[model samples]
Target: MRTALRPHHLRWTGERDLAHAIYGTVVGTAAMATAGAHRTLGGTVATVLVTVAVYWVAERYADALAAAVRGPDRRARIGRALRQGWPTIEAACAPPVVLVAFVLVTGDLRAGVVVALAVSTVMLSALGHAAAKHAGATRLVAVGCATGSAVLGVVVILLKTFLH
Candidate 1:
């Protein structure tokens, strides 16, 4: 098999979208983790997806508006804003799949939720490390960034634990 194309290999965009990706992952994971147990798995998944989509749209809209104030082409600016933020949606795609797969195999929605949160936490750490390294941080700084991100994720999980 061919080697997987790393984000660093991208031409037009490297880790520029990492911020949005991290945000999306956090949003998705938090949504799944905190969704009440009364919700069916499908309902929880739908809620997570809709929540992410809404957040993405709201953020992009604000970006577009900011760009419009600085530029002349409103339509093109909006298009660019949406395109730039697409990584947010892409990043959120994995957690729902994890939730579904775990629920299917374990026959437990809560298990699926915790597993999905863990996966998102891992993604956040990796993204943080990549962002720091891309920014030319030292190795220790990169590791610190990753740890900080993971801690934030853990806090979200803990909130879910207390709430549920």
Candidate 2:
């Protein structure tokens, strides 16, 4: 299977969106934890998972709403919603899983959070690079795309820093 970081096919385009969601979740969750919210690692993981689930559900709901508005058939609209929103819902799982794994292994909650954030940023960077290469962009353009995507992660990090 192609991952966001090593994507090599058209079907892997969904990885790009996953990369963004993962990064956003990691950064946002980490920030909230550091703000004296997550007193325990388990609590942090649970909170993040809940947030991810909510996001996934929200995406599905929005898609269903759009499908209903665009078409008249109930079954067809439900199918359209599933097709349009499944990628994002699936991708959104990556971050919470990563966070949970780290939290479970590492005794230090802060360190676990940092590691999760790093992993998410790396995934985003890889997705950016793969997307550019898949588009047959020049080396400079590819590099730019990678850098730009990675920078978005940094923006999240900055938000964590200032907001926390």
Candidate 3:
């Protein structure tokens, strides 16, 4: 079981981080728009819940993926698998944390959520590339994902502006 959990653990961490970014952005935006400091507390709570949910979902996904990759001798390979996966996890998670912090501080929740989603998507793609030994692919994927996210953000903002 432990062995089966190793590979996907890092990916799960990344996903949880992504969720934190999203929750932080949403809560912060709500707080800022409503002129209520108490919204910060709510945002914090949302962030925690989102993070926890992300962790749980990511953990399950990672375990399943690891199990698929590891096969019968997965237990024996646990340490090696963890060692290999840790860096990818770290790489995937770091950007979202920084971006979330920036969004929260700047009170730009919408942009933050879009960026976070984009980053999360790119990171997932990078992880796939990591497994395949194609580092260059991650760069392209990130750019594409980020561009798409930005477009979505703009569209959302425009719609909100016009509709409201």
lDDT of each: 0.81, 0.61, 0.44
Per-residue accuracy of model 3 over 13-50 as CA lDDT, tens digit each: 44434343333333322222232222343453355345
Model 2: worst 10 consecutive residues (lDDT sum): 1-10
Could you give candidate 2's per-residue lDDT for residues 24-115 as a string of tens digits?
Answer: 44444444344435567677666666665666677678777777776458778877676553444444455556766876786666666666
The candidate scoring highest on lDDT is: 1
The most accurate candidate by TM-score is 1
For 9-94, candidate 1 gives per-residue lDDT tens digits of 24213576887778888888787777756568988998889989999989988888888888568788877887776667777888
Backbone clash pairs in model 1 (N, Cα, C under 3 Å; residues 3+ apart or in different chains), count:
0
- The whole-model C-alpha lDDT of candidate 2 against the native structure comes to 0.61
Clashes of each: 0, 0, 1
Worst 10 residues of 3 by lDDT: 29-38
Q: How much is 147 displaced in model 1, in angstroms?
A: 0.4
Best of the two (2, 3) by TM-score: 2
Q: Give the TM-score of candidate 3.
A: 0.33
Task: Identify the superior model by TM-score, candidate 1 or candidate 3.
Answer: 1
How large is the C-alpha RMSD of every model relative to the true structure?
A: 3.3, 4.3, 9.5
